[model samples]
Structures are given as C-alpha cells and as structure tokens.
Target: MSDKKIITVFCATGAQGGAVARALSKDPDLHVRAVTRDVNTQKADKLKSLGVELVQCNTSNPASVRDALSGADGCFIVTHTDFGKQNSFEMEVHEGRQIADACKAMRVGSVVFSTQRSSRVLGLQTRHMDAKAEIETYMHDLDLPLTCVMVPCYYEQFMGLFKPEKIDNNKYILEIPMGTTPMHLIALDDMGVVVRQIFNNWQTFIDKTIGICGDVLTIRDVAAILTQVLRPKTFADKPLTVNDYRNKKDFPGVSDWANLFTFRMRVDQIFNIHHTKMIHPQMKSFEEWARENADTLHNVL
Candidate 1:
C-alpha cells in the first residue's frame, strides 16, 4: 500500500475545485482524488490524465459524500448556490452540511472550505453569501479540523457577469456598485495555490478562518487597468449606486449582489491581501491579470 496522503477534491470539474485538484496533483507526497457528479466529461478526463482518481459524487446525498471522503487525509470543498434554481439557498446549505458531516464521520485530517462573509451578520440579506457563512458555522459546530478560506470577487468575472457594456464608438462602461470602496479580487487559479499551501501545513490552519485576496482596487482603478492593458478599447467606470444596480432587470441575483457590494463597502478587511501574498508570493494584481487575459477580453469585447 502507498503511504502518500490522500486529498479529496469536490466539484473537481468546476473552476475553484479544478484549480485545487490540478495544484495538488503535482505534489509527489499527496494523492488527489477528484469527485464530480459525472466522471465521463472532458474535464474529468483531463484530471484522470493527470493521474488523479475520479469518483462520481452527488453532494446532496450523504452516502455519496461519505463514500468520496472515505480514507481522505484532506479535502477541498466549494459549494455553489445554484442561483435561478428553486430554493437555491436551502439546497446550498444542505449540501454543505452533508459534506461537513461526512468529513467528520470519515475523520478527515484537514478540510479546506471556500466560503464568504455573511451579509446577514451585518443585518444585510445576501442569500448566496449567507448560505456559505451558514455552512462555515455548521462545520464549526461539527468540530472538524477545518480551514475556512473566504474568497473575494473573482477576477474572471470580467469575462462574464461583470463584462463592460458597449454603448457605441468603441467605448464601454463598467457598472460595478462600489462607490469608492476598493473591491477585493482574486484569480480562481490563485485560490488553488493558497489551498495547496494550507494543505501542505494543515496543522496550523485547523479551525482558522482565512480570507484570501490577490488585489484590492476601486471600480475606476479596474477600468483604468482595462483601458491601459486593452488599449484602443476605452473602458469607463459608471457611477452606479446599489439602488440603481438592484433595479437592473437584465439578470437574476441583482439585489443580492447589490446588498453584497453594500456590505463590502461598509465592512473593512473581508480579505487579507498581505497575508495571501505571504502564502502565494506570485499572486496576480488586477493590472497583471488584465494584461494576461487581454486576448480573451478582446475576444469577449
């Protein structure tokens, strides 16, 4: 029997979990067990090609969660709110609790859970954020050896939800609801780096709540960086208020996001950029990330 440590990664086909799986797969001392709902997908195949073990799992089912976590020395978890689905918040919380319970039953040495600040803690209502917070609390109640890593806004949002709207004349407007507060941002891949370090030194992170960030910049600063990197395509930050943002009917979760932005503005130090840099020295700044993803940005534009 191999003596290498086993690390199970849930949602291994998705962005956050995939990053952790890829990073941990490279370590000679740890064996990566990737869990997904389906193991036949192209993404799962890629992980399989990396010599990672793939297990089919349904987070809602306690039996599946336990089976996947069995014999795991450590695990990385990221549960989605599944917005637009019915009862997303309850479903998310349920899945999280089920996983946490299984981790305890299996006696996993370490569990790294990606979570967010609870807007409800500040008397605000953002269901997705609060759901993660509730899960973090549940894990605490379970008394599992856990490391709660809170991630800020993803830098990758520029490619999708937060993409600037083009109005005409090659000019675009970025509409983020932060008036003057610097928004914390991090690349999903960078999360993998941080989580790997945590697993490498698991004993120190037990029962710790760590907020990780790569860069902190205002919406205007983000626009400036986009303009500088993707020159010839000017981007401007629109002075949008939370009220105005919530009123937008183009997509779902607008109000929740509005409340989240309000909470971030009012609350300070949700994420720690300095400490995150100490963990992963090569974390990317907004400008650096913009430069690196310029080609993709141009394609999207």
Candidate 2:
C-alpha cells in the first residue's frame, strides 16, 4: 500500500477542478483521484494519461459523492450555478450540500471549497453567489475542516460570455456594468496554483475564507489592455450602469449578474490581489492574459 496522501478533485473535466487535478498530480507526495460524471471523455483520458485515478461521479447523488470521497485525505469542490435552469439556485445548493455532507461523513481531512460572497446578506439577490455562500455556511455548520477560496470574475470570460460586441469600423465595445469601479479578475489556471498551495499547507488555512485575484482593473483598463494587444481591432469600454445591465433581459441571469455587479461596486476589498500574488508569485495579470490570448481573441473577431 502506498503511503502518499490521496486528494479527490470533483468535476475534474471542467476548468477549475481540472486545473487543481493537474497541479496536484505533479506532486509525488500526493495522489490525485479525479472525479467526473463521465470517464470516457478526451479530458478524462488526458488526466488518466498523467497517472491520476478517474472515478465516475454524479455530485447531486449523496451515495456517489461518498463513494468518490471514500478514502480522500483532502478534496477540492466547486459547484456550478447552471444558470437558466429552473430553480438553479436550489439545484446548486442541493448539489453542494450533498458533497459537503459526504465529506463530513467520509471524514476527509481537508476541504478546499470554491465559494462566493452572500449578495443576499448584502441586500441584493445574486442567486449564484448566494447559493455558494449558503454552501459555505452549511460546511461551517457541519464543523468540517474547510478552507474557502472565493474567486472573482474569470479572465477566460473574454473568450466567451464577456466577449466585446463589434460595431462598424473595426471597433469593439466592452459592456461590463461597472462604470468606474475596479473589478477583480483571475485566470482559471492561476486558481489551480493558489489552491495547490492551500492544500499543501492546509493547517494554515483551516476555517479561513480567502478571496483571491490576479488583477483589479476598471473596465476601461481592461479595454485599454485589449486595445494594446489587439491594436488593429480597437476596443472601448461602454459606460453601462448596473440598472442598464439589469434592463437587458435578452440574456439569462441578467438580473443576477446586475445585482452581483452592484454589490461589488458598493463593497470594498472583495479580493486581495497582493495576497494572491504572495500565494502564487507567477499569477498572470490582465495585460499578460490578453497578450497571450490575442490570437484566440483575433480568431473570435
């Protein structure tokens, strides 16, 4: 029997969990058990190729969660909001609670959970964020040895959901709801690095909630960086308010996102970029991320 510590990573095929699995798999002192809904996918195959154990798991099922976390010394968990799904908040909370309950029952030594601030408690109704916050509270109530990591908006959103809209004349407009407030941002890959450090030094993070970010910049700063990287296709930041964003009903979760932005604007110190840099010295800034993803950005245009 190997004496190495076992770490189970839930949602190992997705962005956040996949990064954690890849990072932990590199440590000889730790064994990574990657849990996914399906083990036959290309992403799962890649993890298998790295000598990580893959287990099929449905997070919403209590028995499945327990089976996956049966012998884990530590675990990393992230629950998605599944926005636009009916009762999305309730569904997320259920899934998260199931996982947390399993961790408690299985007596997992350390748990690193990805959670967010409670917009509900702050007088707003960002269901997604509140759902995660509710899960965090549940874990705390269980008296589980837990470390909560709160991530800000992802830099990867630029490639998908938050991609700027192109008007005429090769110009693009970025329409984030923050007028002049600096928004915290992180690369998904960098989250892996930070979580790895947290797991490596679990005792230090026990019962602590950490908010991490790679950069904090206004929408205009983001646009400027994009313009610098993709010069021929100029980018500009639109001065859109939270109310304006809330009025955009064409997209799913508009009100939730609008409330989230409003909360962020009113709140201070949502993320600590300096502390995050201390944890992961090589975390990528927005400019660095934009420069590296310039080709993909161009392709999307």
Candidate 3:
C-alpha cells in the first residue's frame, strides 16, 4: 500500500470536484484519484498531466462507484440537480444514496458531500435543496464519518439565471427574488480552498453540517458594487416577490428559485459568512470577486 492517503473525487471534470481534485493533488501527503465517465477527454488528460490518477466511474452505476471507492481514504461527492430538459429530484437523491452506500462499504476515512441547506430549515420545499437534505440524513444513518458542506448561491449566477439586462445605453437592470433580504453568495472556485481545509482537519468536521458563503448581499447591494465596476449610468435593482417570481411562466426553474428566495428571507444567516472566513481565510468577498472578474462580468452586464 502507498504511504500517501488517497482521495477519490467524483465529477472531476465538473466544477466542485475539479477544484477539490486540483487542490488535493498539490498536497504532498495526499494522492488524488479523479473520477469521470470518460477517461479520454481533454479535461481528464489535463488532470493526468497534473499527476492525478484517473478513475473511470459512473455515479449512476453502483458497481462503478464501489470500484472507485475501493482503497480510497476520503471522497468528495456531488450530484447535479438540473440536467437540461430532464430534472428529477428523486434522481439526485438516488445518486447520492449510491455514493453514500459505496463509501460506507469501503469504509472511507472521510466523506465531504457537497450539499444544500434543508428546505425545511426555511419552512418550504425546493427540489434541489430537499434532495440534498435527504442525502445528508442518509449518509448519517449509514454510520460513516461525513461532512455536509453546504455551498451558497453561486456568484456566477449573474452570468446566467440573473443576468443583467440593458434598459438604456448606460443603464442596466438586475432582477432578484429577494426584495431586501440578504442572499448568501460564494465564488465556486473558493469552495475548493475550504474543502482542502476540511480534509486537512477531518476530525474537526466529521458529522458536522456547515454552510459556506463569501458574502451576504442584497440586489441593491450588488448593483452598487457593479456600478462602481461597470461604470453604468445607474445600475437598478428590480426586486421580485417570491409569489411573483414563482408565478413567472417564462423563467426556468421559477418555482425552485421562488422557494429558495423565500427560505433565504426567513434565514439570513444560513451560510454563516463569519465562520466560513475563519475556515478559509483567503476566501474572496463579492466585491473582490467582482473586481477580479470585472471584464467577464461587464460583458454579461
């Protein structure tokens, strides 16, 4: 057996897993085995170039997952909530359970499952959030060491779902569901740094569920920051009530986001920004992240 601890990362071609895989590979005491469905992809080749071992595994297949978990010291698992036209809450739960069972059988030293806060925490049910909550419970029931790392809304959402629209030559409008309640947001890249910290001190986080956020901001707050960066005549905040947003027939995942915003209003401190800063001292704030990505954000705005 190798002296280095092996950490298996699922969805290594995707965002969260890729970040964790890269970070772990840089640690001298650890060895990274990156899992992906295809072993011949450009991304997989890049990971291999960085000294990461490539493991071909499919999350939907129990045997594949089991094989990947074998001889692993720790694992990072995440499930996608949206798959284009096919979105099923139960599918995510099923996949999560599969990974959990595999980890339990293999007796992995530590399992860091990327999850979301429970919908029940805010008195509403959103499909994605609810699925992750169920997975968290299932992992705990299996009697394995688990750390549920709940990531907040991505700051990158501004590039897609909440993209700014031009109202005039020099003005743009930012639409948000939360009227004035602060929404916790984080840069996806920073999630890796935090996860690396968790892996280094696994005992401190076992059986704990932590929500991480880089900043707690409102629509107006975001606009103010963007105004400084984009030099817009005026960046306006257009607040959408949960009811109004949920009823929008044109918006994708309206009901899901509606429930999320409603829950966010009920619990402003769900992400615990202060505690997150202590865990990953180098984490970036919204302003800092915006400044760094100003050119890219400006194009979308």
Candidate 4:
C-alpha cells in the first residue's frame, strides 16, 4: 500500500472550499484531492494546475463521498448554503452526516467543517442553522478529530447589501434587520485563507469550534466605509419589521436568519475582542475587502 496521505476537500469549485483546496494544494506534505460537480469548471482547471487530484464527487452521494475520502488524512467539508436555489439545507446536513460517518469509518485524523456563526448559547430553532448544531453533535459522537469553524456573514454580501437604487447611481442602502446593531462579518476571500491556515495546523485546532471574523461592523459602519471607499452616499436601513420580514416572499428562511441576528444583537464583547484573542488571528478589514473586490463593489453600487 502507498504511504502517501491525501486531504480531500468538498466544494472545490466554490469560494471557501476552492480557496482552502488551493492552499492545501500548494503544501508539499499532503496530497490534495478536490471534489467538483463539474470537472471542467475554471476553478477545477485552476486546481489541476496547482497539482490537485481532481475528482467528481457529489456530496449528496454517500458512495461518492466514500470514494473521495478513501485514504485521506483529513477533510474540509463546506456544503452549499443557498436554500433558495434547491432546498439545500436538508441536503447539506444529510451529506455532512455522510462525510462524518466516512471520517469515523475510515478513521480519518481530522474533519474541519465550515459552519455559520450563531449562538451556541442561545439554542437555535431554525432548520439551516440547527443543521450545523446537529451535524456538530454527530461529529462529536464520532471517534475522529473534529473541528467546527463558525464563519461569520461574508462582507462580500455587502456588495448586495449596499446596492444602489440603480446600478449606476451612487446612492447606497445597507439592508440589515437589526437597528444599527453591529455585526461580526468576515471577508470571503480572507476567510478562505484563514480556513486554509486552520486546516494546515489542525493538530493545534482539532476538537475546537472557531468563530472567525474579519471585522466588527454595523450597517452604519458599513455605510460609512462604502461612502468613503465607493462614493458619498447615505445608509438606509430597510424598514422591514420582524413580523413584516417573516411575511415576505423572499424570506423563506427568515426564522433561521432572525435567530442569528437576534442572538448576535446581545453578545456585548465583540467577536475579534474575545474570538480573536482565543483564536490568535488577525483578519482583513472591510476596507481591505472593498479594495480586493473593487469591481464587485462598483457594479453593485
């Protein structure tokens, strides 16, 4: 039998997984295996160039996951979170459990799951957020080295949040439910790098849940940054009350989202204050994110 060790990563074509896989691919120690729904994607080719062993593994298929995890030392699992597209939460949790089972059955050394940041203190009642909690439970019962990373809402979403009245207009509005309460947001590109770093040193981080964030921000704070970075514009908080927000057509998972914001609204000591100290990490700020994603911000505004 070959003595080589592989680190299999799911969501290899998307943002978080692709970033982590690419970082792992650059490491000479571990053999990197990347899974993609479509092997012909630009990201797949990018991974191929980086010397990643590309495989077509759908997370929804247990057989595929087993094959992907075959002989792997570690796995980075991040499921698709867009429930609006295909009712994704159920499928993501189902596949996550499959991966967890494979990790135990295969006796893989480590499993690092990219999860959302929500209150473990205030018990979650919604489906998608609760899925992570359940998956974390399953991972706990497993004999493998398990780590959960609580990634905050990506500041990249602010491009959408600060969308102008029209594309060309300079006016910007940040749509946050909470009234001027700050949020702990991470930059997606930076998060990818941070997650990769965590996976690289899984020994130091195993069996821990990490809350990762780039900056602590409020809608007002974000608006000020956007105004300074993009153009002088006002930040308008969309007037959707809790009841009205839950009744909207687009908010299929409003309850889940509400629980998170409502929950975060109370955490007094900010994320980086306590979270950064514990994690011993410094991440990118909103200005850095805007500069990196200038085109996205410009088009959004």
Candidate 5:
C-alpha cells in the first residue's frame, strides 16, 4: 500500500482520458479516479479491477463533473466532439468550462486540459481546436492551478484516414499536405506516459501550456518508415488543395479544418526551444512509433 494522492480523470473511457487514467493507474505515486458515462462498460470494470475509483459523470453536465471531482486533488479534462453533433463546438467548449469551474471551486491541485496544437495566434477554422483555444483562455482567466496539454494530430488518426494504402501494401502512409513541414504526430499510448509525470510533479508545472507530440513526420518520411516494415511501397502525398479541403472535405468540418491544415491560419511555437526545455525533451520519431506499433502493422494494413 503505497500512499499516493488521488486524482480524478474525466473521459476515462475515451482516448485521451483512458490513456491518462491508465497511465496514472500504474504509478505508485498517484491514485486514479476514472470517470465514465457508462460505469458498466468493460473499460470501467477494467479500471475498477486495477483499483481505480470509478465515477460516473458527463462533461456536458456541471453537476456530474463536480461530483466526480468533489473529493479528488486533480483532474484530466478532455472532451469528445462527435463529427455529427448538432452543436459540436458548443458541446466541447461547455464541457471544458464545466471542468475548469469544478476544479477551481473544489480547490483541486490542478486541472490538466486536453487541447489541440494550433496557431499561437487565433481564429483557427477548426471548431474543435478553436473551441479548445477558447476554453484554454477561459481556464487561464479563472486563475486556478492548471496545465493545458496541447496535442497535435494523433499518429493513430493516420491509420483511420488512408485505409486503401493499408489494404494494398499492408503499409499506411502519413499524408498531411504541408510538403515535409514536419507535422508532429502523437502516439496515444505515449500521451499517458508524459501526462502521468505531470500529475506526479504538479508543483513544478503551473499556468503552463505545453505542446505534446510523440513523433514528427511528413507524408514522405512516414511512407519510408512504412515501406521498411511492409516493403516496396510508396505512401501517396494526398493532401487536398485549399479549395478542395474547404469544399470537398469528407465531413461538415471541411472549412473549419481547412483553415488550419490548408491555409495555416494558426501555426504556433508552443513547442519552441524554451517550451521544450521546461518539460521532458524526449519526442518520438516516426521510426520509433512504427516499430512499437508493429503489433498493429500486420492487422491495420
């Protein structure tokens, strides 16, 4: 029985939350309060078996989030905005706000928000990222102990995007159309490792916005890595033009997403020299991710 502080984590059933909660669960220095909308889900049951205190909560509801955070010292706040939500942007922003308010009112040691990497400036076309930008600002204004983790596109998302490449050569290509601008990709597994450290050392990080990325790769660089593992393949650089990204986007978020990826409306240096110096400087490369994700390579392709 190692004595550690209890930390409540929101969205514990989903990607960011699950990673954060799972990481915290393994640490002897921290206790995890895993929250979920469905307490009976396998994920929740699994967390319970691992000694996580399960809290049923929804971010959209302040009362639920507050109840989840009521007895905890800290929390990890993240939201899932489905593609087809009637009010996707509002839903995410409101959820974040509710989490922040609960953290402040409850006097939690800190609130770590899950945000996206975008411009240091503002007016990103993507509703989700822009919503994060807004929520981050509000979190700061409240003057509570906080750390905002800014995530880039997940390395996992690439697998979901170009399935054809996965099917043909058993190799998936990384195809973000910045022409080798080094799109930083993050592995979902690695995210938990980094955030676990933050929760363990809460005092050193306050009022900080850190860019979190496990790997960096361009369209071609990733393809090369895939070729090595899968063999004799070229990852296509299939980036849509500004017009196409805005007009021909697969979903309703085309214009919003195009605003950042296509037009570069908000490219920022949150991961600049100084920012990296503050946090752990270790960043994963595409090759490292490919090797670690080898288990999925055969099946994904």
Candidate 6:
C-alpha cells in the first residue's frame, strides 16, 4: 500500500481541477482523488491511467461531495459559474457552500479554493465574481485550513476572443476593449503550479487571499507580440468601447463582462504585477505564451 496524503480535486476533467489533478498526481508526497460527474470520458480515462483515483462527484450533490472528501487529507475546490445552465449565481454559491460544508465535515487539513478578486472592491455586482466572493466568506467562517486564489483574465482568451483575423494580405486585427490600460492574465496551467506551491507551503498561505497573474499588457502590446510571432503578418489592435461591449449581441454575458472590464480599469492599481511575480516566479509573459502556442494561434485565425 502506498503511504501518501490524499488530496481531493473537484472538476477533475475540467480546466482548473484538471490542472491541479495532473500536477498533484506527479508528486510523490500526495495522492490525487480526481472527482468528476462522469467517469467514462477520455480526460477521466487519461487521469486514471496516471494512477489517479477516480471518484464520481457532482458539486450540486452534497452527498457525493461528502463521499469524495472522506479520508482525504486536503482538497482543491473550484466552482464553475460559466457552464451551460450553471451560470446562475445562486447555483454557484450553493455548490460552493456544499463543497465547503463537506470539507469542514471531513476535517481536511489544507484547501486552496479558486476564487476571483472581490467585486465589492470595484463597487459593482458581477454574478460570477460575486458568487466566488460569497463562497470565500463561507469558507473563511469554517474552521478548516484554507487559502483563496484569485485569478485574473486567462492568457488563452486571445486564442478565441482576440484571435487575430486576416483583414487584407498579411494585415490582421485583434479586437478587445481597454485601449492602453494594462490587463492582467494568467495561464490556465500555471494555476496548477501555484496551487501546488500553496499546498507545499500551507502555513504561509493560511487565511490569505492571493491573486496570480502571468503578465500585464495592453492589447496593443499583445498585438505587437502576435505580429512578431506570426511574422509577415502585421496586426492592428482594435479597441471595443464599453458601450459596444455591453451591447455586443454575439457575446453572452455582455453586461457582466462590461461591468468587469470597467471595474478592472477603475481599480487598475490592485493587480500588482511585481508582487504576483514574486509568488509565482515561473509565470509566463504574453510573449512567452504566444511563442509557445504560435501554431495554435495561427490556426485559430
């Protein structure tokens, strides 16, 4: 029998949880209990092959969560508010509380909850961010060891939302809001590395709320880098006005995102790049992420 501390990772097949599950599964000091609603999927199969124990658990079901947390020494909890029909803020908060309640009951030693920076800081109410803020409060009131990680915009957003399009010949356009204001971004994979660091240094992170960002750059800066990577292809940064973003029909959650971006611009001083870099030195810059995913970036457009 292997003697390793069990770490229950919820959403084991999705982005956040999958990253943690993959990272922890490689560690000799911990065992990963990968929880997913379905176990027959390809991602779950791949994780199982890596010696990760698969546990079927739905965040909506408290009993399932309790079963997954049983005998686990630690947990990495994350609730999704973007999935189809799961976008309800109430639903997200309910699921989060269920997970936290289970964690408290299990007496888990270490927990790193994936949350977003407070919406209250900007004096606005964003459903997704507000849900996380509520969950953070619930977790804080619990007696269990916990740490909250607030992530900024994802670096991968460029692959879809800001994908460069060929306008004419080699000229391309990457459109987004925030004309020159720096936007913070983080690699989805880097979240796993940071969570691992938190678990390894549990005492240092207790009750502390930390925000992680891979890079801070304006859309123009990002366009410049994309031009260099996809050479012979010059790109232009097209600024989308807040009014336009709020009314953009093609995008769902336009109002929420509009509020978020507006608030981000208002409180630009809070997402300190220097301090975030100090915590996760391995964080990648936009250029680094661009170069690594060059082929994929090119294919998107």
Q: Per-residue lDDT for 172 in model 2?
A: 97
Which parts of model 6 have CA positions greater than 4 angstroms off?
Answer: 83-87, 120-123
Per-residue lDDT, model 1, residue 156, is 92
Model 3 poorest ten-residue lDDT run = 79-88
C-alpha lDDT score of every prediction, in listed order = 0.90, 0.90, 0.85, 0.71, 0.71, 0.82
TM-scores for all predictions: 0.96, 0.95, 0.91, 0.84, 0.86, 0.92
lDDT of 3: 0.85
Q: Write down the RMSD of candidate 4 (Cα, Å).
A: 3.4
User: Model 1, 1-301: lDDT tens per residue?
Assistant: 1899999999899888998999998888989999999999999999999999999998989999999998999999999777787688899999999999999999998999999888886888788899998999999999888899998888999888898999987799999989888999999889888999999988877788899999999999999999899989999999988888888736777778888899988887659999999999999998888888899999998
> Candidate 4's error at 234, in angstroms?
5.2
Query: Candidate 2 at residue 13, lDDT?
Result: 93
Cα lDDT tens digits, model 2, 30-98, are 999999999999999999998999999988889999999988999999988777887999999999999
> Residue 168 lDDT in model 2?
75
Candidate 6 to truth, TM = 0.92
Clashing pairs in 2: none
- Model 1 gets an lDDT of 0.90
Candidate 2 RMSD computed on C-alpha atoms after optimal superposition onto the true structure: 1.6
Q: Any idea how many clashes model 2 has?
A: 0
| Candidate 5 lDDT, 1-301, residue by residue in tens | 2467878988898878887888888887788888889899998888888888888887778888788887687888887676577688888888778888888888898788887643435644567777887888888899878887877666676566534244354434443546646666677766787787787777776777778766656667777677775555445566546566456547656556566675342354354423533454564555777777766865666
Better of 2 and 5 by lDDT: 2
Model 2 regions lying over 4 Å from their true place: none
State the lDDT at 40 in candidate 6.
95
